[model samples]
Target: MNAITHNTVPTYQRISVKPLAVHIGAEISGVDLSRPLASEEIAEIRAALLQWKVIFFRDQHLSHAQHVAFGKQFGDLTLGHPVFGYEPGHPEVYSVGRDRFKSRFDGARLVRPWTGWHTDVTAAINPPAASILRGVVIPPYGGDTQWTNLVAAYHGLSPALRAFVDTLQGEHKFTPPEGNKARQEFVSKVAATPLISHHPLVRVHPETGEKALYVSPSFLKNIVGLHPRESEQLLALLFEHVVRPEYTVRFKWEEGSLAFWDNRSTAHLAPVDIYDTEFERQLYRITLVGDVPVGPDGKPSVSIEGEPVAAHSVE
Candidate 1:
């Protein structure tokens, strides 16, 4: 949560929306994160997330505990991370920084050849429904994050292409980059990983019933029913389509700024230039537990490696 004066006229379900992008993001200016939110406020925020995909807030400098408290309003919080041990005492807070990234894939030191655009924790059969990130320290110039509207990307495809993708399933897994110095350590920590799960190429949003293109250059390997070359080529085209700038929104983080996004409908990328900079970029995140993704035909995601995520107490 970030601090901002709340004096806007009521609009969509109570809170007004000042959209950051035509398709994906909005600046929600009504609620204060530092205080306990009313049930109406939570409902409004949740509705905005489904409609806008991601929403931003300003000046809500909350502690790790406060961040988790706000996140609980929507759903149960996932562990700080499944594999990486982030924020020891505050198990629900994933603290990220340059020297140590507290994200799920933090310690891998596996640099993504691509922009690392991804929906968080897709390796799980059921990834998180949403994630809330608060900026503790932000750089003056770069380190901005960007998100793309997956639902828009799915709708952008030609009918024939959409039909083709709707029938497809793709393999997803996490493998450390070949040259990581701590590759073995990464393996040791995630002994249950290198997890391979299958999910539909196009996923149906559980809340709004919107369909979104769900594959990514980050973890998605190949389409199930195609040859390696065909899968690669088709996936390449889809990747390009999903990341088109027109379907995206960029947010510049400032200390006390917060970003709460619906992971079910978008892919996010941390700035590449933010790595190894002398300037500090510290942020804390809390993830909401998610359901197994369902495809257009109504089949649910089936795991090849692990069980569905068990729900935990929101408190």
Candidate 2:
């Protein structure tokens, strides 16, 4: 790992941010999430999130309600998912862990090697601006999640390739994986509420104006104007490039750990090592409302099948 340079000064007065990697992740300390945050603290946290793509907090044991409260400090929360239902009573919380149905359908719950790499919900016309996830029941080892900085990945591309990608758009929708065929309920829900949107391949950050390669392997189906073969080859190259080891940071979760990421500028890979193991893992996530993604040309994403994701109204 590259060491933090002396020129990389801390940005927040209220919290201490320790960068985990040269480009992407940071470990933040000095404030409690369970309690209300002061205005200065909230602003600094947002600044840290924008700078570091994803920020981690260790040993914050937050209740479901407290988790929701901390997310509200940043922005209005969205439903846990566009299709999958939320955790009971906590509409904003999406529980992530082992899927019982997948195990029941087969002796071992197997998944496609590429299925876990994705942004939160790209199928929505307006994907979440940010997501806050808290670790619940964690395993003894394994199950580490990894995130890549899309902005850095975009800049890493050759100047000619970046220029070409700037003019392209890609289609995103939720499609059940081949492994999910055995789970009828999973297939049925996806069929009933299909969300499809056409988004710029290179999205301009609404807040920072930086361009990011908006690639979500799990949700993005194809580049809109390219031939099937051409799209596949191009996407394959981009996918492999965006996840190059230099652009990523891996996090090993502890029970009270939490991660907050800017959904617009990052892509994450969920834990693939924990499946079929005897260990148990569970986590809760809530997303903040995001605006329609605008491309370098200033054109916004267009929804083909579903309504834009609406903000959740807390009671």
Candidate 3:
């Protein structure tokens, strides 16, 4: 259960909240990024994440190590990615930038990597519970990210549909970004692992006990029990509804800004407008490992291609 913070009591106050959207996002002010956080501060931050699915910070520029430190206060951190490589000597920090991608795929025709919304690592049995991303370089215009509240999406569905989906499961596959097959940065980063996993269609959030629609356009392949035509139709209907404007909030990025989101309750879209241009945008991400997702029926997710994330402590 979430511990409530009292406005009358001043002892627990340290951070200020400026909501970015009515439903899903908030901008947290008054915390220093360069230094360690107090236990009280971490508590409020976690509470804020529970109240609002995603939170943001402005002008709190953080180094790679600082980013990881902030994420550690939440829970055990995961390697940057299951198959995607991270910066040398810092396996916890996944580097995302234009120059970095170009260096890896020298002569390939590159396009914007994100056109859809997704959770951090749904292909694994234990996808990331949450993530902290810091913007190192920002483009002048047209590089903004958005997140949707799956909890809201699930509630928006009709009663009959909700009951029907509650008993179903879906497959999430780790495929490369569209347009370039074997030439994509992610596919060639490591030996291609056929990462696949089955998760409940409606996941029960371990923290808040909220049931969120656990579907994404990027990783979801099909509904497990339905026919091929039925599966595609169901997926298409849910996918279109998940990103409706009422359930989402968009963030305009600036250098030194950071966004922390609950991957278990939200799905995000990477900016695709800056493709085929001179503009460059870069960011660093740290993912916190989470428990396997449980459906409304109380079944835990299972993996096929990789091992589940185990808990760990690191400085």
Candidate 4:
């Protein structure tokens, strides 16, 4: 693969957003999400995602089909969880509602915990490449999503820290039995379809060739070759480091808005702030398929805790 150079920045038209990145992310105006995008427009959006890693479009009146169509322009759509069905005719789209699920940290009884920082589907063998989230019904205040630039996060790490991480691997699972019983039971029913898998401590971006920290507080279980207590401490430290606010951007949602992010180079968290209200918050998400992960080294990456297989390494 060719090295990603600073000169490789792609072209994009900007919307009237307060902050503008050099090319990291942009808001596009003058386009309606409910309508079909022209070939050129879709091409530009795809290129922008490869270049910027995240894109936001506001005031989209998209139906399930329209949302799926937008996602398909970038790549093949991965079906939502086999067990959890999507809205009819939109198998790729998954619904998130506050009525059924609750955020784990905030004790918000209806919101889902995906608001925690994580890349989409990191526990899967082939994690999602990108995700498109459409805000259906947003609260008047207190629910926002924050995204961190993993490339920037990795670049900010001390060289010694990066070197140390390069030598390590982590176990990832939906939930572990060791956690709270209710949490474990919920995850086991909704998230525990498979055993744990291991991934490299560092991941190389598929398109950018930039290195990023890949572990998340939600799915990452333990480090290989370390005692349980030692692994927990180390993981806790790393998780805190990865979510530092310096490398992050927060986006407050509005009804009919959509946010698309590259899973390969970003980690995100949803905030659960609304509680004990009659308000209903809902969102729909579509995930695109991705290739196997690779590491910075030019060798195929192997998981540490389980059987190692020849796979595309992040290099």
TM-score of each: 0.89, 0.92, 0.89, 0.81
Clashing pairs in 4: 115-270, 294-313, 294-314, 295-313, 295-314, 295-315
Tell me, what's the RMSD of every candidate? 4.7, 4.9, 4.0, 5.9
Where does model 1 exceed 4 Å of error?
A: 1-10, 101-114, 177-182, 312-315
Candidate 4 structure quality by residue, lDDT tens digits, 183-283:
43455454535535667778877676778787766677788778999897878777777777777777878988899888878888866566457677888
Q: Is candidate 1 or candidate 3 better by lDDT?
A: 3
User: Considering only N, C-alpha and C atoms within 3 Å, which residue pairs clash in candidate 2?
Assistant: none
lDDT score for residue 315 of model 1: 60
User: Residue 71 of candidate 3: its Cα lDDT?
Assistant: 77
Better of 3 and 4 by TM-score: 3
The residue-by-residue lDDT of candidate 2 on 58-77, one tens digit each, is 99999999999999878888
The superposed Cα distance between candidate 4 and the true structure at residue 193, in angstroms, equals: 2.7
Q: Where in model 2 is the C-alpha error above 4 Å?
A: 1-10, 100-115, 178-182
- Model 4: runs farther than 4 Å from truth? 1-10, 13-25, 102-115, 176-180, 183-192, 299-315
Q: Give per-residue lDDT, candidate 2, residue 117.
A: 78
Query: Which pairs of residues collide in model 3?
Result: none
Worst 10 residues of 1 by lDDT: 1-10
Better of 1 and 4 by lDDT: 1
